[model samples]
Target chain A: MMMEKLTVYADRMSQPSRAVLLFCRLNAIDFEEIKVDISKRQHLSSEFREVNPLQKVPAIVHGNFNLSESHAIIVYLNSAFPGIAEHWRAKINSAMDWHHSNLRQGTVSYVINTVLGPATGRPLNPNAAAEAEKVLISSLSNLEDIWLNGDGRFLLGGSQPSIADLSMVCELMQLEVLDEKDRSRILSPYKKVLQWIEDTRAATNPHFEEVHNILYRAKKKFEQQRSRVAETGTEPSNKIGGHSKM
Target chain B: MMMEKLTVYADRMSQPSRAVLLFCRLNAIDFEEIKVDISKRQHLSSEFREVNPLQKVPAIVHGNFNLSESHAIIVYLNSAFPGIAEHWRAKINSAMDWHHSNLRQGTVSYVINTVLGPATGRPLNPNAAAEAEKVLISSLSNLEDIWLNGDGRFLLGGSQPSIADLSMVCELMQLEVLDEKDRSRILSPYKKVLQWIEDTRAATNPHFEEVHNILYRAKKKFEQQRSRVAETGTEPSNKIGGHSKM
Candidate 1:
């Protein structure tokens, strides 16, 4: 039986979506990319709901099978495709599962509360930001002290990068939107985490950088907005401009 | 090479731990059970940290390999053990990944805020509980409308219960500690969700009840405590008694 072409519905601004996109490109898997602009609430539209009832981006359609959750999507692709079976292992699976509630939760919460919330016209929630920062610091500490403790540069000490590395590095990439001081203050304590992120990016290389271009654009736009606020000499409104087109 | 015996580190009071325990029992996988009582703060012990540096329950030791995260443990067990490969599938993987931020988060947050907080001498946060309730209601609606919409009794419409079913059902079981009024009010609108829970429970009976015996005991104790509070004419402390021994 011939396999149907795979379709990925994602938004690069969304971390997990970028992971899936980068993974496909890295593995040389042929697929179509359908951008779902979450900032515009496109993910909530009725049509997207048909693809994922949960109405989230980074969902996939292979033939009649539809699946959501980036970890699941990557795992399925690895299983369904060829030449990538070596990357899927028990340790990697453990790392991916740990990512959801730990690293992923912290980075997403911190970035959303501090940066994305105001950018989207939601008020900056100081209390929430403080709470999220604690989780972020603790999660980073775990990455430095535990996960990267092994001799291997990647998580669980594997010499080669795996799906876990891709997914997590994508998550940490959200910090790019933070101003230099805030980002450095939060990330500086974890030498290992910093090196691991660099190592993951180096491993994935061109595809990793290519998929993250959207975030880099957003980061640039965010910095420009901050400077404009500074120049106006008024009380900083804290809100940045809305999402840029991908 | 001879295979070494597996040791499961868990505490039944924890939802994911029970899921791991039930999966092992259901699959008839020979293993040793090592309880890590979270209520007593045993999971925070230095020794437990050696087993899982993240210091969470539902971890496993398979020979020299130590794995945490219930989803990972269940997946690993299914792959490593005999007679269980049929149960592992992409859809099930999707459901498990989705559970972390959806059903599992809502249930765990709501329970901790309203029931577990005061019981553990932590002050109640009505704001958090209210927020958690909204997420809980939304999650229940999703489970009913999307997951259980299919003809099959379990999630994603599978006839035989998968690890996703065990994990989610165990998470939902936390609501048993709530008073009847609150539990009914929260769960009533989702008819399909209610039925799915029953179907999952029935499909995994005997062992299900046996594993959940600790929760049943906790429920009875909670009810007795509520009656005492009512007789005393005190404002409902909103805290149930501390975790009962397994």
Candidate 2:
């Protein structure tokens, strides 16, 4: 009998997509990956809409079960692959689960809404990037405090990594890739966070080395795209001065 | 054995705080609520800051386990009380946990950035409000599509309510309390969402009704506070204006 296949629809640059990829790798789950070209508006296409109407990446199609949202996918996968040589269930404990759903969500939003938008030329205002930096810094300070006070190992109290680690590490990695300034700011003051990154990378599967490589390449692509936009002197779609009424 | 005293530190008008209150009511979790006065800037007070340096509401103290962030609180309560005689876990699974996180977060940001500031007599750039509205409308559309496609009972697959329902409902309620016009435009088109609200209210524990009443009272108080700010004609906090950056 053929192994049950998990088909992940993802864009390598999306932090959530990378989280899913890392989850599959860590669990030794057999899956095929199909890249969704977010840059080309592939997610907006009708064919992709059938799979996930939200047009978001990090969706998984497992036979009849179609799923989106990286958190749900990670939880479902952990539950499905209970015997995959990892203490999967323990990772979804009270604190870590909450962290994944709340603090992580807050930080990621701050990064995306503030940092990524401005860096990519889709900011609501020119000053939006600086505002995001302030919020991001404040949130990072809170995270650092949590690490100092909490178990201080993996995001949860574990010798091994879990979903919480996967969720957070991916977001942090995405922030790092946004620009050298962001990377330096995040890594400089948060020394423990830097160590956490090393730990998570070491824990992740070697297959995901390809996924990591893809992020670096995507960052380069994003820079090139930004420069092209600058050269053409054309504003991006979501900018405040563009079609935005506000 | 003393029943575990879960003390909630909250400001009822806040969306996240309401989520925690609703969850406790839905699950019959015994807890005490300590209202933090947002009107007097109590959240920013050093006393409150010790509990949560981020100074956000929806923080909880259950014995030695203190936590902030509404989503985290719900997940923690659900897990901590697994025998609560409900399909809570399944509710989290089907409620578009991942999608709801993004949608609810975005909606709250929009409401805070656009409506709340203006309602409180803080000068809002009309252009900024309009831009925030556009993003908010897009998120609401996605939510409407999800409801149109899903089980149509609760947010998840259950005939009963879940954490997702609480989170989304609180956000909608926040928008409603902030700007009646904006709420009508955003919520009126989705019939199923309206039905979901009715269903959730009917299914929730009577204790939650009390909490809802408290929130209503708090909303009125918040409105008064806004009126006072307008009357005084003082400049709003920079943090309040910083939301648009997100």
Candidate 3:
């Protein structure tokens, strides 16, 4: 089959977007990346609204199918491109579906709502943040259980990397950036999960220079905010205290 | 084929659980309903945790497959019971997948975070509410566009209702109950959506009565809180909101 041109609407820092990017790379699906400027609120702009009114990242324009939602996009990719590895595709689908309701909304939302709120100087709603953290801890604990009990090194039964591994690793990476304590909590108990992340990274092509470029830009922004706080003689807003008892 | 017994862990007021009930009623999938007491937080109990450690409702245990997440459960139902209108199944699957990450999360979260919060005298986070409303409005607008422009009366092209209609109707109903003004907004422009709800109700069996019971129960709880606020100057401590917005 002739390769169709795929345009992925994404920001590299977004876990969902990373999931799609990694999926495309693994499947060897020829695609072009269109960075949606989430910082400038371009996603909500009229021009981009024409593309996705929902204004969320991880959208795709493939031929006649203009799809949003990372899970839908990945599913469409797997169904449309049949020549890719079957086991990997199935595993990715299962994990992506699981992540949508469980980890993404559950854990990732926790980090963004709680830790990232103070980081960005957004008014942190303590009640919502606490609820989010409760959900996040449960989700992370579940991930540990699944990783410990599951038959494969990755989430599903496969030796090669899948979209599941990609989606999960990105979310965990976000969690790591949010709180160093959380990184320890997630990794220390889940030995297989830690190993799996390393394995998946090694198995895939590390040519995410473009991905790193986006991350570097975000880091620069973070540093600027820190400097502003320092100059103002204000306590750093983003820092979280030690982990609380479950 | 002999029908597989399905056990649904649900509460009637929950939008997602209602979606499951609607699916079973439409597809003639026989299942026993196990209502979780949201008022008492029965979902958080350790026994229930084994079924879904996340402690959310609209989970299912069918044969050997134990699944959580409303979208996952609905998809599994469609897949397991192919007798439930195949064309409608595909359309419903696509629509549900789209809505899961978009409309469902956005609308449901907005309702809970904004309307329900103020009604319960909980500390209302206006920023979260505003952010939620932006997403909710866009989702509702897209829903209007799709229903108006799409190929069929229902979400997918079929005379009978599918899981998409079930999932959507439940979410819309939650939005409807949140506030009279918001309800008017939805009812005014979305005639087709209103029609879809009636059609879904009329086509399906009496299972919706159970759904109505749960909704009204929630409504009663909200009213009681209002009355209590009127009588005494203090707010209720254990105010249970609607669904998780998963």
**What TM-score does model 1 achieve against the real structure?**
0.94
lDDT of 3 by residue, A1-246 (tens): 246677899987787888788888777789999988765566887877767655778788877557776766776687788787755532244456667656667666666675566665565566776776666666667776763356766675576656677777777666644444555764577666677767766776564443445655655655566578779966564444424343
Model 1: fraction of native contacts: 0.77
List, residue by residue over A1-246, the lDDT tens digit for candidate 2: 125678999998787898889888776788899999886778999989888877889888887677887877777776676565554442243334455445565556556664455645564343554555665666566666664345746764567776767777777777655656656855689877778878778777474566778767757855675677879975444433335544
Q: Give the least accurate 10-residue stretch of model 3 chain B, judged by summed lDDT.
A: B85-94
Give the per-residue lDDT of model 1 (tens digit) for B1-246: 026789999999999999999999987888999999887889999999989989999899989889998988888888788667476588888888888988887898898888777677677788889988988998898888887777788887788888888999999999998887899999988888888788888989888999999988888877887788889965444433544443
Q: List the residue pairs that clash in candidate 2.
A: A246-B127
Q: What lDDT score goes with residue A193 in model 3?
A: 68
* Candidate 1, A213-243: lDDT as tens digits: 9889989988888888789854334434534
Q: Order the candidates by DockQ, highest first — what do you get?
A: 1, 2, 3
Comparing candidate 2 with candidate 3, which one achieves the higher TM-score?
A: 2
RMSD of each: 3.9, 5.9, 7.1
DockQ, model 2, C-alpha based: 0.24
Interface alpha-carbon RMSD, every candidate: 0.9, 4.5, 3.8
As for lDDT, the candidate ahead, 2 or 3, is 3
Top candidate, metric DockQ: 1
Output the chain A TM-score of model 1: 0.93
Q: Which segments of candidate 2 are over 4 A away from where they belong? A: A1-3, A84-125, A148-153, A179-182, A205-208, A220-246, B44-54, B88-91, B94-96, B99-101, B118-122, B205-209, B218-246
Q: Per-residue lDDT tens digits of candidate 3, residues B64-122? A: 66777777776667667767665443334456766766777777677777656665545
State TM-scores per candidate.
Answer: 0.94, 0.80, 0.76
